[model samples]
Target: MAEALQPGDPAAIGPFRLTARLGAGGMGQVFLGESASGRRVAVKQVRPEIARDPGFRKRFRREVDLAMKAGGFWTAPVVAADPDAESPWVASQYVPGPALDEHIAAQGPMDEAAVRRLGAGLAEALDSFHRIGLVHRDLKPSNILLLDDGPRVIDFGISKAMEDGGGSALTSTGMVVGTPGFMSPEQALGAAVGPASDIFSLASVLVFAATGEPPFGHGASHALLFRVVHAPPRLDGVPPGLVTTLDKCLSKASEGRPSAHEVGAMLTETAAPAAGRPAAEVDAGGIPFDVRAPSPAPESAPTAPNPRAAGAPAQGTYIAPARRVPPPPPAVAPRIPVTPSAVHEFAVQDGGPAVFRRRIRKSALWTALITAVLCTSTALIGQLLAGVFLSVIAILVGFLPRLVGALPLLVRSSLRIDARVLQMRLGGTAFTVTWQDVALVSVSRTGNTLRLVVVLHSDAKRPVPAPLRRPGADDDREAEFLLISWNDQAVTSRAARLHATLAAAAGPAYRPPVRG
Candidate 1:
C-alpha cells in the first residue's frame, strides 16, 4: 500500500521522519513515518490547497481531537499531530496490512469466517466512533485496512466533522459525503446519518469482502446513488449463511438496519451455525467477552455530532454482560392474511411482506361484556327504570375506547407495508402513509407498551392512523401514529424483524428506535 517518497515530500514532520508515500486521498497525502524512539506511524498532512481554508482547518483540528478520543481498539488511534501547523498533519499507529479494496483486488473474496471477522472488527470500530458521537460518513473499502489482528477504520474526521458543524464544506453539488455503491439511503438523500447508517455501509463492506463487488454494482456516481436510494440490494452471490443477516443490514431505512453491536453479534455468533441453520437466528448478547474495554454510556439522541458536547466518558470498570439466549417461541404459525384493502396496494411490493395481526377479539369482547353486565345488573335489580336507562348510557360511554379497538379485531386487523406506502388497519381505523410524506419512523413509549410509530411531515394529511394515543397527541392521532405495540409478542412474534422491516420499507424515514 506504499511507494517510495516522491520529490517535494517532506523528509521530517515534527519528531517523525517520512519514509515512503502511503497514498493520497480526499483529505491529503499520507506518508509512512517513524518516531525518534522507533515507533512506525502513518502520517497524513492536509493538502496545501485545502489546508488554507478556515473551515477545513477547523475540521482538521476536530479530527485530531476525535482520533485522540477514539483510543485504539479496532481503530488506529492518533499518536502525534500539529493541527495548528502551516500544513496541519496528524499521525496514527501505522497498520501494516493493505486496504480492504486493494486486498480484494490483489487476492479474491475472503472466506465466510474471514468476512465474519472483518464485520466484527469493523462493528467494534464503528461502535467506538458512535459512542464518541461521531458518524464515519465516509465508510468505503478504501477507508478500512486489513490487519492480521482485525480491520482498522480510518478517515473518521473530515466529512462527518463538516456535518457536525452544520454544513457540507467537504462536498459540493448538493451531495453528501460518502462513497457511491456503499452509502446508506439517508446519506444518499443528505438526511440525518446515524449509527444505523454506518451499519448499512458495514453490510455493503461485508458483501464486498465476500463477493468481490459491492451489493450495488459500481459505475457512475449518479447511477449508484439512485440505485442506493430506490433499489433493493443485489445479494445474488452472497453466502447463504450470511444472506439473511446482510439483508437486514442493507435496509434502506437507518432504523431498519441492526445496530453495529447487533451486527457484530450476528456475524460473530459461533454456535457453528449447524448445517442448514438460519443465519438470522443469532444471540443478541453475543458481544465478545475477551476483548475488554469500557462500555460507553448510552447515547441520549441519534443525530449529527458536535465535538464540544459529545459527552466525556464517565470513569468505571466495565465488564461484558452475561449472554442470555432468548428461548425459541413455543409455536411458529404462518402469518395471518392482511386485510384486502391493504393487501392490494402492497401486492406489487417485493416478496416477504410483513403482516402484524393477532387474535384479541375474545379478550376485548369479554372485558366489554363484563363491564356492561355489572353495570346493568345493579341498576335493573333495583327496579329504577330511569337509573337503568342512565346506567345503559353510561355503559355506552365507558365502552367507547374498547368498542373502537374491538371493531378492527372483529373484522380483519393487521399492519402491512410496501416500498411506497405503510397501510395499517387498527382499532377500527384504516389509513395509509407514503414514504415521501414520512418525516421519520421511530419507536416510542406509550403507557407500559413500546409503540412502533410513524412521525409525519408537518403538512402530511391528518388525522394520522395510530392504534392508540401517544402523550403529545392529546387524543388527536396527528402527532406520531402508532402502528403496533412492539412489546406484545401476541401482536407479532418477530419484534426485531418487524422493526427492521418497517425501517426498510420506510427508507429514509427510519430513525433509531429510541422510545421517547
Candidate 2:
C-alpha cells in the first residue's frame, strides 16, 4: 500500500525522513521513512488538530505503549516514539508486503492450507496483544499484510487499552472506533469492547481471506454494523477446516468465543497433514509461518499439464464426485473435536496481579566468599609479622557490614505496584511514587544487557532524578530518586514475563520496551 508522498507531507519527523506514504487512517498519516543510518520504518504522524487535543495526546501515548506490547514474530514492533511532539509521531519496523485487501484483489481467495497459516499467525498476534492487556479493536484485512512468510498485523491507531473489567478505556463520546463489517456485536452496540471483540473481528478477517468477501458482505457503514450485531456471519465459502472456528468466533455473545490461544491451536489441529497440502499456485498462498514455498514456473509450451486439460486433470484442479454423496466433514466439521494441546495452549497474562522483583546479584555471594578466602590466606602468610593477622582480621571484619548489606537477602532493590502507588525499595532506602507521577515502565536494550526503566510523567510535582539531572550529586542524594536504575541480569531471558507483569501493573502508563 505504498503511495508517493503528497505535497504537504513533512520531509522529516524527528530522525526519520519520509520516503513514501504508507496509508492514512482516522488518527493520521503513516509514511515510509528511513533514518540517516538507513534503517527503514513506518512513521505515523498524528493530525495537527488531533495532536493539539490533550486527551488524544494522552491516548496517543497509550497507543505507543500498546503497539510496543503488540510484538511477536506476527506483528510489527515499535522502535521509537514522541507522543509529546507538536504533531506526535511513532515509528515501527517496516514490513515489506502488500496489505491483505490489495493481495486479495490482485490474486484471489486463499486455499484451505494458506488460510490456516494466516489464521494461526493472526491468532498468535492476538494472543500476544491479549496477554499484555491490549486489544486491536480494529482487526480487518487492511490492517493485515500478506507476506511470503505470513501475515503481519499493523496499525494500532485506534486500538483501545482495556481496564480492570477488560473494557475499552479510550473511546471518545459518540465515536465508535472500528471497521463496521469487521467489528463485533458489542462494538456495534457501543458496548464495552474487549479481547472478545477482537476475536470476532479476527474471524471476520479469516472469512474474508477464505471467500474474497466480507463475512456479512460490505455496504453502508450503519447497515454493516447492524448486520454484524444482528445477523450470523456468512461463512458459506469458508474452507471446511476453518468454518467451525469462524462460527464460534462470530458468536453474538462475546463470552461464547474462543480465546486467541485456543483458536490458534484449533486451526493447527484442524488443518490437513501439512505435508500433503499443496503449495499456492496463487501469489498469496504457500506461506507456512517458518518458511515460504517457491512459486511454480509458468508454462509457455502448449504441452504443459493443466487441471482443466481437455484430456487430463491439472495439478490443483478439483473434480466433483459422481454421486450426491455426503461430503466428509468440511475442514471445519464440528465432529473433529479439539482436544487439549500442549503446544497450542499458551499462557497469556490477562491483567492479573503479580509481584515483580528486581534481579538478585548472584555474584555477590561468590565475591564475598573469594574475599574471605583471600583475607584468611593473607593473615596466615603474614602471621610472623605480629600485627599482620590482627590487622587483616580488623580489615575483613570492618568490611562485614558492607559485604552483608550487598547480599541478595539483605539488599533491597525491588518495586511493588499497589492500587494507589508504586512502592520502590532501592539501596536499602524506601520511597513511594503516586500513580499520577509514574507514566510507564519499559525494558530497553543498551549494549548487551536489557534493563527496566520507569518513566515519570513530565508534569509530576516531584520528579525522580534522571540521567539528565545536574551532575555532582553524592550517592545518597542520587539514590533517593532511583526510580529507574538496575542491571537486571535475567531481564533479557525473562523479557516476556517481565513485560506482561509490568504492563499490567503500569496499566495505561506502560510502554513497550525497545528491541534491537
Candidate 3:
C-alpha cells in the first residue's frame, strides 16, 4: 500500500500531481503521481542535496537516457523527466505489483515454476539493457516488480552507459555504488563492470526468489561484499533444475557465465510446466494446468465381464476370450564394419613408414623463411651482445610458425571413414562421430576460407575434448573444423573430397550442398 503524502511533500512535479509517497531511498523520494491526462506514474524526486551537486545532475540525465532506451515488456518505461527542475525528478510507468523482496516476505518463497519464469523475464530485461549499451549496476530484489504477467525491472538510478566509462567521478576510483548483497565480485572489488556483472546480480536475485534468502545470506555490508567476492553462493534450498544454470551465472569469472540470452534459453528449456499436471505430462509439453478432476473409475477403463456371473455357459462363453498376445518384435540386423579408407598418405623423408598426414603449404614455409632472413639481417647491424640476442629471437620468430603448422603431421592418428564411425586424430586429441549421432555434414565458405560444419543430433552426447573444442564450438548442437588452406587459395578440391568422404560415412544423415 502507498503512503499518503506528508505535509513536507510537494503537491506537484512538473504536470504530474503527487498523490502519495511510494517510498524513499538514499537518492530520493518516490511518489505516486497522476498526470494531467489522468495516467498514473511513479515519480522519483531526487534529494535536494543530490540535486544540488553537478555530478549528480549529469548522472541523473544519463539515467533518464538509459531508462528511455530500455522500453520493453519487462522494464518500466520512462514516461517523463525534469533534470532542469529545482529538484530533479524522473517518472516511469507505474507497475502494479509489489517489489520482489516485499512479495517474497509477504508470501513464502516462490515455487520452481515461478522462479524460472522470473529468471527468464529478468534475463530478457538484462538483454535489453545490454543491447542499448547500458548496464544495470544495481540490480536487486527491490528493483524487480513481481507483476501478474511477469517481472518488471525498475530503477536505473545506478545504471551507466557502457561507453560513458561505467560511472561518474563520484563513483570512480574506490567508491563502490551497488547494494552489498547483490554486487558481483568485480563490482565488490571496484573493478570494471560490463553486462556480465548484471548477469551475476540476476542470478543472486533468482536465488532470493527461490529460497527467500540471498545467495550469500545476510551479513554486514563489508562481510557480504567479501563473501560475494570469495565465497560460494549458499544455494541449499534452490531447486536442483535451476541450480546448474544459476551456478554458471554466478561463476567467479565473468567469461564463464552465460550471456543473458543464453540464460533465458536455458531457463525456458528447463522450466517446469504449470501446476495440476503430472510431471511426465509437463515434460512432454502436454496440457498445462490440467485442473479437471480425474475421470470416474467406470469411464477410465472398460468393464471386463465378471468371472462369478451366474449361468455362465462355458469357460469361453461369458468370460471374455483370452487376449491375443502380441507377436515378438522383428530382429534387428547387426551393424557391419567397413575397412577404413586411406585416401591420402605422406611419409617422413627420414626413416618413418608411409602415413596419411596433412602437410604445411609451401607458401607458408616460404613466408616463414623470408621473415627469418629479414630478422637475421636486422640483428647483424645491431650491437654485438644485442645482435646475438636478436638473432635468437629472429630464429624463433621464423621457426615457430613452420613448427606449429607441421606439428599435426607428427601425431600418431588416422582419419578413417567406415560404416560405424568417422574417426580422426590430430595430436593427442581424438574425435569419433557415430552415424547415429550425425545430423548433417556440409562444407561452407566464408570469404576465402572453407569450413566443414558437422551438426550433431540434439539428443546426441559426444563430448568434445578440450583441445578439439573451437572458440565457440562448445555449443552442444554443432562442431566446426577449419579446412586446410594454401596462402590465400581456396581449398575447394580438398574440401570437396573431404565432404564426399564424410557424406559417404554419414549415410542418410549427410546433407549435400544445393547447386547454385
Candidate 4:
C-alpha cells in the first residue's frame, strides 16, 4: 500500500497530481499520482541535487527513453517524462501490486510453483530488455512487482543502454551502480556489463524468491560485493530441480550463463511434471513447455496397479511398465548468421551540430561562472594573491581541459556502410570493421540524441571513444564498440529509417531497439 503524501511532496508534477508516496531512494522519490483523465501513474521525481548535475540529467533522460522503449506487458510502462523540469521526473503506469520483497516479507518464501512462475515472468521481462539494447542494471527482488497476471519489473533508474552513451555518472572507478547482494561478478568488479549480467542478477533474485535469502547472504555492502565477486552463491534451501539452472546463471563468466529465452524454457521444462510424478513420464509427452498449466494425461493411459489387492501369493512382485525419456531439447545456438545476404550500403553523419554547440557553450559558461564565484569569494576574504593563484589554477586544472574537450564536438563525424564493411570517422580517429567481425548492432534515442552501438566479435580490440564504446567496456569480453552517436532534433524524424537500413545491412546480427 502507498503511504499518504508527505508535507513537502509536490501536489502535482507535470499533468499528474501526486497523492501518495510509493517509495524513496537516494536519487529520487516515487509517488502515486493520477492524471486529469483518471489514469494512475507512478511518478519518480529526482532529488534536487541529482537533477542539478548535467551528467545525471543526461543519463536520466537516456534511461527514461530506454524504459519507454521496453515492452509494456512485463514492465511498468513509461507513460510520461519531464526530464527538463525543475526536479526532473518520469511517470510510469501504476502497478497495483506489492513489490516481490514486500510480498516475501509479509507472506514468506514462494513455493516451487510460484517461484517457477516468477522465474518465467522475470526471464521474459529480461528477454524483452535484451531484445532491445537495454540491461536492467538493478534487478533485485524489490524491483519486481508481483501481480495477478505475472511479475512486472520496475525501477529502470539504473538501467544502461547496452549500446553507446549508457553509462551513469554515479558509477566511477571503484564505484558500482547495483545492489551488492544482487550484483553480477563483473558488476561487482566495476567491469563492463551486458545482457548476461542481468541473467546473473536474475539467478540471485530467483534464489532469494525460493529461499527468502539472497544467495550471497547478509552482510555489509563491501563484504557482500566481495562475496559476489569471489564466493559461490549459497543455495541452502533452493529447490533441487532449480539448483542446476540457478547455478549456471550465477556462473562467474558472463558467457557461461544462459540467455533469458533459454532460461524461460529451462524453467518451463523443469516445472512441467506435477509433484511426485516421475521425470521420465513427463518427458515422454513431447509437449511444448508451458509453466501455467500441466499437460493432461492421455485418455488411454493405464493406471498404476495396486500392490495391496487380494492375490493368491501375498508377496508376489509385479513389474511396472518402463517409461521412455524424451531427448533433451535442442541447444539454443548463439545468434550467428546462417548465410550471408547481399551487401547493402548506407551512411549517416552528425546532424545536430547546432544543438551540440549550444550545449557546449552552456556547459562552458556554467563552468566559468562556478570558477569565478569560487575565486571571487576567496578574494573577498582578504586573500587577493591566493584568489588570483587559485583562479589561474582552477582555469588551468578545470576550465581549459573542459574547453579543449568540447572542441571535438565541432568535428563532423560520419558512419559509412558498405556491403561487408562498417567504417566511421570521429574527429581525428577512424574505426573500421568487417561484417563478419560485427556481433550486434543496436540503436537508442534519448530526446534529440541518437546512439548506434556496434558490438565486435572479440574483446581483444583497443577501447574506442565513449560515443563508440559499449556500456561497461571494462568487462566487455565481446568487444562491443559504439558505432555512431549524434544529438539533433531534426534527425529524430529519420531515426526509424536509419535503424531499418542498418538492420537490413547487418541482417540477423542487428538487435534493434524495442519500439512499443
Candidate 5:
C-alpha cells in the first residue's frame, strides 16, 4: 500500500516543493510541484511497494538522470529528483496540455495532415532519445500531450531506465514493462527490446489518434499479450497512407522495422508538397497518398540542380521548349494504388499537358489486342443477323484501340501524384505534383482496417476535382484518395519509401518533414 499525498500541505523533496497530487498509477504517484524559483514541475514518487524493491528505486533514479540529460521539442526536461531519499521522486518540466487521449476525446479525431505531422514529430523525438542510447519502454497515448504550441512526449526512460539500472521490472517476474494494449509482441513475450520496441509503441500511439482506440482493446493483460503476439491488429478504419508505416513498425520481429528517423523522414515528405502541385487529400475519415503529376511545366522554369547528382552521375540534362500556357485548370485528385509495375514511367505522355496520354509498352499492346479480338469475335457471332451488326462490328474494330487507350487513362488519371519534378504514378491516371505541392502523408489503423491519406498543396484558387469516370461530369467523383481494402499496409510502406526518395530530391525545402 502507498501513502496518499494530501492536498494543500507542501511536501518538500530535495530543492522542489510538492504542491498537489497529479495522479496515481500502478508504479507511483505524480504530484504538481515547484522549484525554489517558482518554476512548476510534475513530480513522481515511488510507491511503498516499489520503494521496498530497491531495484525499482534504482530504475527511477536512472530515469531521472536520463531525463535531465535528454532535452528537445518533444520531451519534457527534468529539473530535480531524489533517488536516494526515503521516498524516491523524479521531477520534470510541467507541460500544460491535455493528454492525447483527452484531447482526441474532446476535439474528436485529428485530420489526416495533422496525424502525419504528429507521427513525424514523435519519430524525431524518439530518434533524439535513441541517439543518446536511451529507449522509452512504456509509450502510450496518456504519455503524449497536445500542447498549444505542439505535441510533447513525456515519461522518458523511467520504466526502462529502471530495468536498465538493474532494478525490478514493472511487471512481476516474467512480466513486461509496457501497457497491455500498446506493448510490442516481444515485450509481451518477455523478450528483449531495443529501439525497435519504441517504434512499435509509436505505431500504437498513431492507431489511437486515428481511431481513438488501441490495436488491442481492453481486456485481461495476459489475453492482450496473446493477441499482440499472435494476431494481426484489428485495423478497421485507419487511413491507407499510414498502414504501411504502422504495419512495419508493429512487426513482431524487431528486425522487420525501420529506425525512428526513417519513419520521421517519410512523414516529413507527406507534410510538405512539392512545388506547383497539390499535397495528398485528407478528410475526417483518413489520409490518402495520391501523388498526381502536374501538366508539363514550362521549360523556361529553371530546374534546381540536384545536390546528389553533383558528385555522382554525369547524365546530361534535356531541355524542352518553353511556352507560357494558361494557369493549369483545377486538377483532379486520383485514387491510385501503389503498384510495383512501371508506375513511374506511366506518368509521362508524348504531348505533355496539351493532350494527356500514357505511353503503352509493346507487351501492353499485345495484351490489349488479344482482349479486343476475343470480344469482337463474340460480338460478331451474336449480332450476325442484323444489317447494322456488320457496321457495328466494323465500328467496334476501329474504336477498340481508342477504347483500350482511353480506359486506363480514365481510370488511372484519378489516382496520380506528382511532387514537382519528381513524378509518381500511383494508380488510375499518372499524377505529377511538384515537391512543394505536397503537404503531408499519414497512416492509421482501426481494428483490422488501415488507411493512408495525402494532403495536396494548399493556397490554390479552387479545390482540385476528385477523380471521376464520366468526361466533364464533376458531381460523381472520387475524392483525391487511395484505398486498399486489403494490403493497405503495403501501400503505406510504399509511401514511406517514396517519401524518402522525394525528400532526398527536395533538399532543404523539405524542412523538418513532420507536422505538429
Candidate 6:
C-alpha cells in the first residue's frame, strides 16, 4: 500500500484529490479519494510497469468499459473512468463494508438465512452481467463486500464481453484466470465458458458463506483445480435445501448446471418452505421430490415384452400372504465348496413395472448350502463320542440357511436411497411391501456402537412383517443411521435408476432428496 496521507497531501489527480491509501493488489493500488462534488470513491490506477505496455492498456480499457456498464443493485455504482490519461484509472462508489472473506474470518460463518440472502443477492448480480452477454471472470469471496442490505460483488477488471472474444494476454497459456478455489471446471481448464461458469463460481461463493470456506478450500492452485474438475463439493454443514442446488451448479460438466436465473428462482422458491410450520412438509411447487419406484407384483410380468416399450402402468394390487419367512440365521461355521449349477434358479426380480424377476446363475446358493452341510455333519458325528460336540454341530447347522440369505441383504441395505418397497428373499419365500405398509427404519446408539431397526408397518388384517435386525444393532432403533452402512454409492445409484423407472410410469418428474 502507498504511504497513508492526510488532508491536502497534494496527490490530487484531475477533480478528485487522493485522501488515503485503502489497499493494493497485484495490478494496482486503491486509494480513498473524494470527488469535487463531495462524493467518496475508491480509485484504482494501473501499475507504472504495466502502464507502458500497449496490450495491457487495451485490456485495462476493456475493464473500464465493463465497470461503466455493469450496473446493478448488488454492485457498487461506477463513478468515473479515464482510459486515455497518463495512467488509466477507474473509480467506483466507496462501500463501507468488510470483504466477505474478512467477515467470515472475523465472525465465523453466517447462519442459513444470511447465506440464503447472500446467494439470492449474488444471483441477481450475476444475472445482470449474464443478461448483457458478459462474464465476470473473477468472483472470489475477497471481491465481494458484505453490506448491511446484502452482498455487493466488485472488481470486474477481468470481465470479458462475448463480443471481445476471450480472456486477456495475462491468461495466454490457457491458464486459469479466476481464483483457484472458486473457478469452475471449464474455467480451470481454460475452455470457453457461458453463463453456467459464473453459476458454478457463485455456488462456490455460497459454500464459503455457509461454511466459512470454499468447496475446494485452501490449497495450492493446481490441487484446487483438480478438486474443481473431479471432486464433490465439501459441504459438511450446509443446509440441505441449498446443497442440491449448489451441487447442480458445481457439476463437473457445464451443461449439467442450471443458469443464474434458475438459481435465483430456487432461492426464491425455497423461502416459501419457511412460511409453513411443519419441518418436513412436502413442498407443493418446489423441486420434484421422487425417490424410488414402486416394486412390480409377480403376476404383472409382461408377455412378449417390447425391449423399447414405454413404461406400463404399474399394477399395484396387493398380494395375499402365505407364511412369512424369517431372516436367514447368522453364519456359524465354514463348509465344503459345492460344484456350480447345483441349486435351482428362482425368478425374484423386484421394483420393475412389467418384468419382476429374471433367471440368474444359481451357483452361489448351492455353494453355500453344500458348505453348511459338510460343517454340520462333521461336528454331529464327533458328538456321539462327546456330548459337548453335539452343542457345536447344532449351533452350526441351525443358522446356515439364514447366514446364506443375509450376505446379499447386508449388501442391498447399504444403498443410500429411499425405496418404495424393500424386498428380501429367504429360503423358499420372499418378503415384499407396499410403502404405506412399511414403518420407519430405525438407527440407535448403544454405548459406543450404532444399530439399525427395520420397523414394519403393523396392519390390522395381515401377519406382522418380520423385524430385520442390523448385525450390530441388537434390535435397537435409535442409533445414527449411516446412509453408507447399508446402501453405498453404487446402491444409491441403483435406487435412483429404479425411481426414474417408476416415475416414468407415473407420469411425473422425480428429484431425490439431498444426500447427507
lDDT of 3 at 403: 55
Clashing pairs in 2: 240-331, 240-332, 241-331, 241-332, 306-314, 307-314
In angstroms, give how far residue 268 of model 3 lies from its true place.
Answer: 0.8
Residue-by-residue lDDT tens digits, candidate 5, 371-475: 566566757778434535554554566545754644433333223333334333434434345545545544344432333344445552233334312244343
- Candidate 2 residue-wise lDDT, 60-127, digit = tens: 68767877867777898999999888888889899887788876665556666767778888998899
Write down the lDDT that model 4 would get: 0.70
Residues 1-516 of candidate 1: C-alpha lDDT, one tens digit per residue:
789988888999878999999887667888899998889998888878667766777766776787688875678888888978998888889887679987666555655555776788788888778877777777889989865445788765454642474655555434456787888888877776778888889999988888777887654464466568766777766768889999999987677788877887887765253234233222233433222222222364222222223454232211211112222334632122222332222111111113212324444465567656666776677755755565566556655554464443344445666656777665466777776787767765444244666666777766564443456665443433343342444334234435545544555466655445
User: In candidate 3, which residue pairs get closer than 3 Å at backbone N, Cα or C atoms, i.e. clash?
Assistant: none
lDDT-best of 2 and 5: 2
Which is the winner by TM-score between candidate 1 and candidate 2? 2
lDDT of 2: 0.65
As a whole number from 0 to 100, the lDDT of residue 240 in candidate 3 is 86
lDDT against the true structure, per candidate, is 0.64, 0.65, 0.68, 0.70, 0.58, 0.58
Q: Candidate 3 on 1-516: residue-level lDDT in tens?
A: 599889888999989999998886536889999998889999988878667766777777876887897898789999999988999989999988779887666544665666776787788889998998889888998888865455789887667778775456545634677888998989877778899999999999988888777987664455466557656787877878889999999998898999999998988776665455444222122212222222223443333333333443332111111122222434842232223332332111111222213233453465557656656676677645655565556547655565565564455544545557766565566788787887777767665455556777888877655655556875756655554444333355455445545543454566666667
Kindly report which residue pairs in candidate 4 clash with one another: 192-472, 192-475, 468-482
- Native RMSD of candidate 5 (Å): 24.5
Each model's backbone clash number: 0, 6, 0, 3, 86, 16
lDDT of 4 by residue, 1-516 (tens): 689988878899999988899887546898999999999999888888667766777777777888888955789999899888899988899988778887666545655656776788789889999988889988998889876456789987667778755445566523577888898989977788999999999999999888778987664465466557655677877878899999999998998999999999998876754566443221122322223322333556433333423443222121111111222434742222211332322224342466567766776687678778877898799877887787677668766775565555567556665446677666666677776677787777766556677777774354455555557666432333232334454555356445635553565676766657
- The residue ranges of model 4 lying beyond 4 angstroms of the native Cα positions read 165-167, 276-516
In model 3, what lDDT does residue 206 have?
89
TM-score of 6: 0.50
Residue 442 shift from truth in candidate 1, angstroms: 42
Off by over 4 Å in 2: 164-170, 274-516
